[model samples]
Target: MTDLTELGVAAIRDGVAAGSFTAVEVATAFNANVAAAQAALNAFIVATPDKALDAAAKTDKARAANKPLGKLGGVPIGMKDLFATAGTQTTAASHILEGFIPPYESTVSQKLWDAGAGMLGKLNLDQFAMGSSNETSYFGNVVSPWRRNDGGNASLAPGGSSGGSSSAVSARLCPAATGTDTGGSIRQPAAFTGISGIKPTYGRCSRWGIVAFASSLDQAGPMARDVRDCAIMLEAMAGFDAKDSTSLDMAVPAWEAGLSPDMRGKKVGIPREYRMDGMDADVAKSWDDGIAWLKDAGAEVVDINLPHTRYALPAYYIIAPAEASSNLARYDGVRYGLRDLPEGAGLQDMYAATRAAGFGAEVKRRILIGTYVLSAGFYDAYYTQAQKVRALIARDFEQAFQQCDVILAPTAPSAAFALGDKTADPLSMYLNDVFAVPASLAGLPAMSVPAGLNREGLPLGLQIIGRPFDEQGVLNAGLAIESRAGFTAKPERWW
Candidate 1:
């Protein structure tokens, strides 16, 4: 029997097309892997084997009928918890939304299904997509299948919000998974897990049914083992949606078909702002290696400055939470999900009690901060100022793009840390996103490619950021890094 779980999106598509194996066989293999790894990785909140088998059956029927296979035909993938999957529970790793299953599907997931992808299940994530580490998940923090090289057995985090997606993809529990990047959720996790992930330019993927984290920053992308797989999945996930006012009304480019190792005449930018105080030596070295790889691939290396980078993290916290406060307001106990109503309590009392009991600590903290910043008295002083700073940050990217085609930097300051290492200090946890947040604030396309492993054998990622709606350029640059880095390390099957 073939180890169908080891095949990537492109390989699976070709195999299925060639009748090397039935789609049902592929789905069965992955479903069993997901079931076995659930306890150890905590990757999936729920497993939907029936859905996978059903989709795979359809693919088999189409092949039997001599119909053209869909772009992702017969490939099974994991859906992140934030994306509503009609009948399956779509909790964003929060207790408040526990047992809540949307009647509608997220645009991205629906598109993936239309392209013939099967769903293994809804993956876990940080509650409300609020945390930088996976520790904020209500179900439990996801443990990376990876371990230190020198003999320590401490369980490390797979990075936040999209941590489950990263863990599953990295562990080979699934070939690829859908991930949402709101302030680095997708990239950070991908980096930590030694996988490739991309956050398409804002609005590239419709946000209609995906749980809103930061309305502007939350973007759906693919997390996979390599750049080619990410490209294949991303092409199937991105398109315009009339329901989403912010959806980009543009043609979805065939990114996978355009994948080329040739980087002749491309200028890769190394931002001076990314060199921070107290930076990890390993991360710095990995970044230097990435630059060398790009140069070797025939791309010109240039130095660029994004002066407003320092203000990005602060501005992001403000803007994202403000938008989150507004979007999450609909989740009050009155409509759907958990509702804690004290006996004889009035409407206001019920609302207060429900929220207090239902929301996680991190969600509440962000809500409180958001409400305070958007308060009548403080709005101008904080919210308005933050918006101005956000514009400045965007302008900084605009100016820098003139100097180079794409900017390269470390995805995170360091490699994945042990669970609970930074949870106590919220500020410290927030800083993990410092390197990935600026591109998000500017609504540009950014991707993370596993460059190398740290001394401790933990994965480190190099980020590539491109101009708006230029995911093709970003993916091309990533291919250069992917080709040169040749990162093929996988976590030992400790799980």
Candidate 2:
């Protein structure tokens, strides 16, 4: 019998449909895995085993009675702490929101429950989803299960602010998990952990109850072991929500149906501008191999230039933090979350003390920078200019898409780095999002798929970017690459 903990959502659904497995049994297996993995990785802020089992029991009873099942049936999944879950602590891995439980669940989480997907728990993340590395999280950093290939040290980073989601999913704690992307949280961590994750077009998934970082750029997405599983999860996750003003009113495509191997007559663009100095040679080789595979599949590979790529990282830093500062202002003492008392302090003093005591260093630094950029004297010079640059970056993608159906590039400059390697230098941390920020700025749909491993045997990933609301193109392209890559699940040392 196949191990329930290792089966993908689609496979589990198939098993349940065929009477080969029961939903309760599947849930129990995954719950056990979560308990074992959480002790080592600290992946979750909360684990709702009782809730999951109850939901799974209902699914099993429905199956026995021949009642219709939802798409996800009884698959176990993890929610990033950013999404609000009714009656559960939605801390976003920050001390400020430590005790605040939402009276309502986010639309995405509700949708998953409605579809009969079982929730394992809320996963840890960078506080308010602000930082590129998981180390900035108030809960502590997540360590990758994959060790150093050089045999130097066993400890390594799992990437962030969705690091816990990726780490847990990659570690087999759950078959798949939901994640949010403001800058590159979903794709970066997927790349680092050797898994597949997709960030649909901006506003593809509603942001109603997700703890906001940058309202304009924030998106919720799916992370799984492979592309097809991500497609299944994305299908359940994407839709319009009246609650989120920016939610796009569009039809969610049949993402899994059109995954064809025949790429004949399709055009793929290779952006020349993504090749930066100091890029790892292994990543470059993987890029070459990916292009070769595309050619083998009969797709025309053409080199294109996104000249404005150089300005994307800077533009993102200014805009994301500016929005973050505004969104996070609600966390002051009186409204919700933690309150600091400075021994008979005044209102202003209490507010100041609360923030100083509750927020992590990176969160505070971002708030300061965000406030500065939006200040009267610097508003036009920084935030406004970055907005203009963001438009230009989008235009670059528009022009590139005019020539090709999809764009391919390295997901990150390198694989996961050691913990604390770049935390001290914020700029170096920001640079990790170099390849992903452009798509986020353009509101384009993008996905990361594990392509191959480097000489060091660490995993490498290739990113596929599609035109706005063109998630079908992204998924189809990812399917093509996944088939050729032949990458399979491997047991991590920590697992």
- Sliding window of 10 residues with minimal summed lDDT for model 1: 1-10
Per-model TM against the reference: 0.99, 0.98
Global lDDT of each candidate:
0.92, 0.88
The model with the greatest lDDT is: 1
> Could you give me the TM-score of model 1 versus the true structure?
0.99
Clashing pairs in 1: none
lDDT of 2: 0.88
Encode model 1's per-residue lDDT on 1-495: one tens digit a residue. 668888988888899999999899999999999999999889999999999999999999999999988999999999999999999998999888999989999899999999999999999899988997788888998888899998999999999989999999998888999999999999999999999999999999999999898897889999999999999999999998999999999999989889887789999999998999889999999999999999998999999988989999999889998988888888779889999999999999988998898889999989988988999999999999999998999998899889899999999998999999998999999999999999999899999999999999999999999999989999999999999998989998886
Question: Following a full C-alpha superposition, what root-mean-square deviation does model 2 have from the true structure?
Answer: 1.1
lDDT of 2 by residue, 163-184 (tens): 9898888888888999998878
